[model samples]
Target: MLRTYFPLSFISTLILLISTCAYAEDHTDELHSATTQVTGFGTLGIAHSTTSQADIVRDLSQRSGVGASGRTSLALDSNFGLQLDQRINENTDAAIQLLARKADKDFVPELTWLYAAYTPNDRLKLRLGRVGFDAYMLADSRQVAYSYTWVRPPVDFFGSLIVSYFDGADAVLSFQDAQQGNYQVKLYAGFARGKSYTGHADYDFSLDGSRILGGHLAYQRGAWSARLGYSQLLVKNEYSSLVPVLDAFHTAPLATLIPDAAQLSAELGMQNKRIRYLSAGLVYDAGPLQVQAMFSQTSTNSLNFPDSYAAFLSASYRMGKWTPYATLSASRPVSAQIPLQPPANAPAELVQLYKDLNDGIHSQRNRQSTLSLGLRYDLSDASNLKLQIDRIHSREKFLVRKEAPDWNGQTMLLSASYNFVF
Candidate 1:
């Protein structure tokens, strides 16, 4: 499966490159005078974890002990991506991006964004086809540049319970006035139906989902920017006994040992299941100093999963080639009622163990916090380097008979990347 998928993804990338080159050649005369350009950027990173309790794998662009207890191993966070832009005419253009990474257990390149856009005038623009929505000004650009002064965006705050990339269409409208300063309002609605990899190990749920609607509004004057945005998603899962069984171990204890009969009854009880989220953010930038903060909450009633809330604050200062930054983030689980045991006919030991586990798990509501600090250096216009360290503390107790183990882990990471426009 790895061999087959790798080659297929490579072939598709090759086709895109060739097509882009061909298009450039056909418009060479226009290219000389046109502002259109093609650009590419990538990162190469390596890090090691010092603690034995957690494995240091590159989950995203940072080295963290997250999900390390199962397969504690060293890993790399290497990724490459490309962007293409064509200026069809003044005030109108098209652009697309592709990214390859070790997001899955194997290497695969995914279509990050592909869209045609018309700027029309400076205050408004329209886009069609797989557009990238900048929920925050820096949100869309987060992963592309490793120069951001953090091992990774605080996971507690940025983690999405559902899918990341969205498909379909969107638009942006801006309003500018001399006395009122400048305000940008963006409205977008889309639907996406595809398979996405959720970070959890137990569930490899194939997604047949759609994004109902979302939008962002921002006001900026001088060095300060404030944004308010809301987005909602409707996701459906195709049942798989194997995937659920694997995921159950990680879910709350009560949901883990459900009997076959109880599972059937619960399925019947849940005729409708939906996951939804809403988020907002704010940022301020002054000479040599920058600050940002965000808050998000999510709810899913049918999965017996608790409603979740996350928030983070980050600040950075630049001095010459070096920029130092600090970040703090936290998340908590909501409350929910889930199944705890099977039928009376089940094994005596199994039933007893299940009860003990469930009781322990119920005590562990959502509770986790992370602190990070880092430095960033801009080597040049096309290259940069970054180093970041993270300390994570998970307070939720496990449902096992014994007390859940405490997670106090530290992670260090070094990363470098280059960007070029062709």
Candidate 2:
């Protein structure tokens, strides 16, 4: 039997919130003079997509997007976050972060990070609890809008991530070479539960307890930084929504047309599967020019899930308080097309099943590229305003919602945002 596992962070957050509230009633003085610091960051934004056939979304977690949801919507990139950092001792510290965004119908807040760090020596540090997914360069700080040049992370490269945090422990080791080149190595292991929003409903995915491990190597020199990373996960998921589809495959009439119906059913199930990811990133910054590039690939053991490749490059130049940038990004599935064709004389039920199966396949497949041009004006040290335009060429359905049958895939997007940190 299979069951959905709720994220542990939710329980932890409730416990912490209650304890702090009760304690504050008795020790308000201690709370005010405690060794703690509070900080926050957010983005106020709106966007428009030229086509009304489908709505463009930042990631799979969002239920609505920019086009069909509205001509202009704040749900795409607008968000807020608050963080508290407390120093427990000279060698220990703890932090918790709460984030609010349009993941559902309304702005709901959730605990994104809650971790305790211990540093016993200058060269090493350890952390335990729910930590950010550090699979790529921007994975940890992707929510801090003021830290990046783009209005949003490129959809082709960042939209496919399934989870952002994992309950785990990690160690970081720092080293310095003879020429004073700095290097760092990080290793982590954890269990996670996350969901992807299918047009119908949420599909819960589990990373099976302790079935994840990964590491990354990073190097830094004068005006350059480089990183290489690898990670693998074991998936144990049971999609309750797919029961009806599987039943039809096993039925008498449809089974007669597809003799290997049982095999096909097994291929559609997502259980005891493993996925591997590899990534590389480079950045250069000097004076008024900065350039960034990254590449990643994902391969999975499931037959219906396609292997994919994604990459992006961005360049920006700063002139006084105004900066201009350009970026190009693309992603596509490399796996062979699924062989799900049914006979022409098949029954009505079989034809309907074919359409259902095809849509499922297309949901995971991506073939798209985008060219973005944008400019940023600094409002202050803690805030900035940006305007961007993207010419999107989507050969296949990409990061979008409510795809219409008669819609073409070509479109343009105009976006603006105000980013601030405190």
Candidate 3:
């Protein structure tokens, strides 16, 4: 089967090696045969960073990081997942995947995907329940580390997208053309319930009722493929960390600094704000050469949240069972200007509050870029080993914990991982 923009179709990409075996069971009145498939993937990785000031994390949902937390850590890049697929009749099937990964400083098992797929015809398919968030090209299968060549996805491009799955539904429409190749369009809607760490241990929050809606179009022709996607998410809850800040806007010295404290407080609140994301990606795999590139833009209605642009380009060449790859990724904010600042002679506490507020406005101004080189060696048909090194440069805080007093905005990261599929 050819890959499409749907999660089920993505199994044909790199995880197609999941072979099915038959099993027998006794029935009292009748005898029947059914195919129940079990498949799993995992990565055991150790990563090291040169920086000892700020810590590095894979995504925003994680509470701990590598670097300052520890120069080398296994919890940073290590994860495991298992999936079960059951076929019911010819047109309907169900699948559920359980994944164990670090979130909120603990390795917790959670259902990453649980859906029943109905294929009414050859060209259409529908799914309901918890489905993978397909906002980017690789997002549908991002948890399956063995499906990709990189030891891990680039942090600069994927780190901030904390939501992995949404509980709702999706539909996929596919068409095939002899001359143009396969075309697929997918649309999805759901509400997310993902937890996020706010860099402070005491300031975690959940996206309980955030509504998400998105769609994508994908085109594949032989060894080349392309995808364009757009998504809009409306945040429905406020951060607990902001309660004090909002309260402060109505209090003594802070209220004296501005006449429109209420308005500024509203702008700083994340509740009920809609964020828009747009992305485009291209991939080519021909013979021994493979290339992938993606660019994305994100904007939010909240004045405190800065707009951002992120992009990455990767290429690899295969030689027998070994593959060598290189990647370049970057992310930058549209503006770094502070939304509001206090006067020079303001009280020290009020001045600090304004500075914190300004930092929140330009929080996305990391101006981060990274270059990575890696090698992957096939250990067997079901497993592979990878070694990679990345040089990261940033003008501000990258995807990391709060900065230390002497922290620099550059670091060299070394990683080693063994990825397996069973």
Best by TM-score: 3
The positional error of residue 289 in candidate 2, measured at the CA in angstroms, is 0.9
- What are the per-residue Cα lDDT tens digits for candidate 1 across 1-422? 01122346655765676577668768877776776676666655544434445433332222133233322222244456778777788877888887775554343667778888888787788988776545444566555655455645666665443344567777778887786768877887776544432222332344444554778778888887777777665545543533443344445553445435345434322124455666777778888899988887766654433467878999999998888999988877765554465456766765775675454334334455778787888777667677766676645421111221454533333333332223
lDDT against the true structure, each candidate: 0.57, 0.78, 0.79
In candidate 3, which residue ranges exceed 4 Å CA deviation? 1-32, 178-180, 198-203, 250-257, 343-349
What's the lDDT for residue 354 in model 1? 60
TM-score between model 3 and native: 0.89
TM-score of each: 0.74, 0.86, 0.89
Question: Cα miss at 125, model 1 (Å)?
Answer: 1.3
Q: Write one digit per residue (lDDT tens) for candidate 2, span 369-420.
A: 9999999999999999999999887776646777778878778999999998
Find the candidate with the highest lDDT and give its number. Answer: 3
TM-score for candidate 1, please give it.
0.74
- In terms of lDDT, the poorest run of 10 residues in model 3 is 20-29
